[model samples]
Target: MRSVFHGWWVVAAAFAVTFVGFGAAYTFSALFAPLQLEFAASRASVSAVFSIAGFLYFALGVVSGPLSDRWGARRLIVGGMIVLAAGLALAAAARSLTQVYVAYGLGVGLGVGLAYAPALGAVQRWFVARRGLASGLAVSGIGVGTLVLPPLAAALAQSVGWRGAYLVLAVLALVVGGGMALLVESDPARRGLTPDGAPPPASAPPPRGVALGEAVRTRRFAGLYAGCLVCGFGVFTPFAHLVPYALDHGIAPTRAALLLALIGAGSTAGRFLLGGLADRLGRLPALLSMFVGMAAAMGLWAAASDFAALAAFALAYGVFYGGWVALLPAVVADYFGGRAVSSIIGVLYTSVAFGTLVGPIAAGRAYDAAGSYLVPIVLAALANLAAAAIVAVTARAPTSSR
Candidate 1:
């Protein structure tokens, strides 16, 4: 048997870290009900925890991406694992809403922020030729993690309580995530091999990087950023609120949590399947398809008064939303080149942060005032539709819009 390439090991590390990091974060949806009961907090207010954590998660990428280039992914990931475990432990022990905010918002946010970019960036550096497949395969863990974690979390909440579940997650993060960190190589140079195990090209120097300043000024970047902002709003708000939303519709808690699992299952497929389509059809088209799908899913969610409709929403949203996540690295790599793919992705992801930060808070407010998710859900679908239009127009034409 041929020895597994070290690059695949790096992919393995990326997968494990993502599974733990994202799985823990996604549990916030299931955590919402318990937190509301304990804290007597309103939906919008309790959701601030997720909003703040997500904000810090995306915002800190600016620092972590550059640091990953200077230091190494392994160091960042190891450090992040420590921080993540501590944050989960801290959040678990909190007595008040403020403590929850500090622990999950700042602590968890900072830890996840530090790790995510470096992990994905390192994988991108390792697989130049198979960039899409490697990234999709690696990020598939996010979907799998999303799929498996929520139901287990719901079960734990019902049995041991949410705090115990959190402590268990803290242990899992430290053990599984930290051990995997050892296997990651921040750059392929450390393995004495070029990216994708390719031989060094003759005579030509490596391509120069696109400066962040130059990249932001481009029409393409502007459009992509705008689209991400909208997509983030549409996708993440539902992620944070889906379980509770289903519960509001009179669904059983476990079955409501299964809605999130369906998203994860569909996403796992999307990351791999649509990721390959991005290689063939172009990243913009793949993104367009998924964005449109997410918009329609949201519309279905708005009308969903029954289990079947909600389940359909979960499955559709999971596939498209997962496709969006998987395609991002390839899109950034293709547009910006690998010179600073992580940094570019990190910057582009600020739009995602913008979406995540605003979406849940806004949705919460809508829920609080109107006692229904109809407004925001419809708005989310509109945002996604607009995102699709933005990508189609800007990518096809050189100008900002058609």
Candidate 2:
């Protein structure tokens, strides 16, 4: 509880954790082929491993969020880092498919779930006036990590064995996540302020908190949740499948790798630019624009045949998608109230987990059936368009205390 003037430093720490932790998780796409060959597994079986990891990462967030609210961010994040490191290290030595699934799907999934909620929740507590910008800066670490890790992972897999890559990743996770945990704490109670930076009155009792059920029952809560679901589903397509799709399209592996890297770069820019903009345009408009822009980016990906077009699509899409992730949690807090923001946001985030589970599996299945990425990319574009439509139509109105 040191009195730091700039709470944004906390956000920067959160970003660093997310950049390494979640970034490594999303980079699994680059690991799929290596894993499949490593274990002599079929594509379907290999895909299931990552899908399970995605599901656990997302589904567990529902509980992790509430737990963070109850337990505080520091313990949860440190614990998650330990679990993530252990899981990755174990996976490096895994022999059976079941071992791999348990190491990755259970350990990594739970670790991410534990870490992600608290990271955002801590950042949410630290700022109010510039909530959008703060959240963007913190979450944009995922973008930075995504850009940096996947290609690095691909290279690691090529040079060192995949097992060695996992060992290196585990070490990276421990170093980054552990260091960031030192900077993370819970609410500003130690600093004598509510989330909005207002000093609590000397004699006034604390305000009543909202229950989870009551929060969910509100109209605004439902709207925000639906909007986030669409946000989750729409932006993930290009992210999850882009690397493989590029290689399939006869692009050089290095160029395909760069395309994914551009996405990470775009996401970092988007989180800052769009998030800062949200503080001005109002959060709802910012989110709505993200959905629309993401839909367009997905379409661009489906249509692009060359490196330039694909790179442009990644740049444009990554920016909006990154902003959407950063802003939505803050938006959840704004519309629903902050008392249960972590839990509410966690539940809302399940849609992304669901999308992550479905996107790669569905895309891979479609590719298997059709013998091409064309149909799957088109379908992903259509899904994004539909998500944009849903966001456009969802009602937004402020709700009073429940």
Candidate 3:
């Protein structure tokens, strides 16, 4: 009897890793109001907590990517989970917003930063033909986490208080994320198999492609970097602000929080359905559609007011957002090959880091000043359209060397 391929196990582990890490990180939506009330802070200030954490998690990918290449992904993933758990635990004890920033922002940011890229990159090394499917399945954890965790955290906060909720999440991060991290192996070669479980040829060369330096020098990388950076400005706006936006419209808190779950639901569908579809449709084209789709979704958000309309916007936005997350790494692998893929992916994500750092806080400040999310929502929509233009231009350019 044939044993199941080990790559699938790696994918499962990556899924769990992302689920725990991102679930915990994204639970900030549930914590946002509580923290704001507790700290007596302004909207932008509270939003900065998430922005800071988001920035670290994405930006740290540059360091974590290279480290994963040199030291293997498993250790970094395990260590990151531990750090994340500690950060959450410390956040539970915070007496001030600054402490919360130091505890949650630095902790969750660093933890996800350590684990996310390495885990995502490890999956890339294990499949070629089904890379899109596997990558989608692995990252669908984020969508799923986004669906499940925020509501759970909101419930926990109701029962146990927000600080206690943080503590509970910390334990979950340590146990679930850390245990799964153990299963993450860096490459298929270690298991005496090849990508997609093909029978190994007698003399397969090591994974070959351009080095990170050369890859970064290419026009393709520049286009991807620029597009992602621009897209980043709008990509995370909804995650941090959607609940508040819903609340301002007189939605009940519980139902408002569930709107994020709607996003998670849409995101999950997109990753699973669109991911497989991209393999058939051409990933680059599918990717361009995602940007366009998101642009339209943001436009819907700008016009939405009632629960039904907002829910529609959430689902649409999430679908495209999920596809964008699922496709970027796969697209990077497609163009650049496996060599230095993790490192290249890490550097590319810095564009997202800068955007994440600014986008949400800017939205919050816009809302505070204008007493409406209109300007930011409209801007976010335009940003996605700009990203679509950049990606379309990239599609016309020649492919980079492997």
* Predicted structure with the largest lDDT when compared to the true one: 3
What TM-score should be assigned to candidate 3?
A: 0.98
CA lDDT, candidate 1, residue 366: 89
Quantify all predictions' global Cα lDDT against the true fold: 0.83, 0.77, 0.90
Give each model a TM-score.
Answer: 0.95, 0.92, 0.98
Q: What is the model-wide C-alpha lDDT for candidate 3?
A: 0.90
* Backbone clashes in model 2, listed as residue pairs: 19-141
From the highest lDDT down, the ranking of the candidates is 3, 1, 2
- In the range 1-402, model 3's lDDT, one tens digit per residue, is 258888888889888888888888888877788888999999899999999999999999999999998899999999999999999999999999999999999999999999999998999999888999999999999999899999999999889989999999899999999998898998888778899999988877788777888888788888899999999998999889998898899998888888888999899998999888898889989999999999999989988898999999989988999999999999999988888888988999999999999999999999899999999888888888898888788765655544
- Candidate 1 has which clashing residue pairs, if any? none
Q: Which stretches of candidate 3 lie over 4 Å from their true place?
A: 399-402
Give the better candidate number (2 or 3) by TM-score: 3
Q: Best TM-score goes to which candidate?
A: 3
lDDT of 2 by residue, 202-230 (tens): 85454334667777776666666665554
The Cα error of candidate 3 at residue 175, in Å, is: 0.6
- Deviation in angstroms for 172 in model 1? 1.1
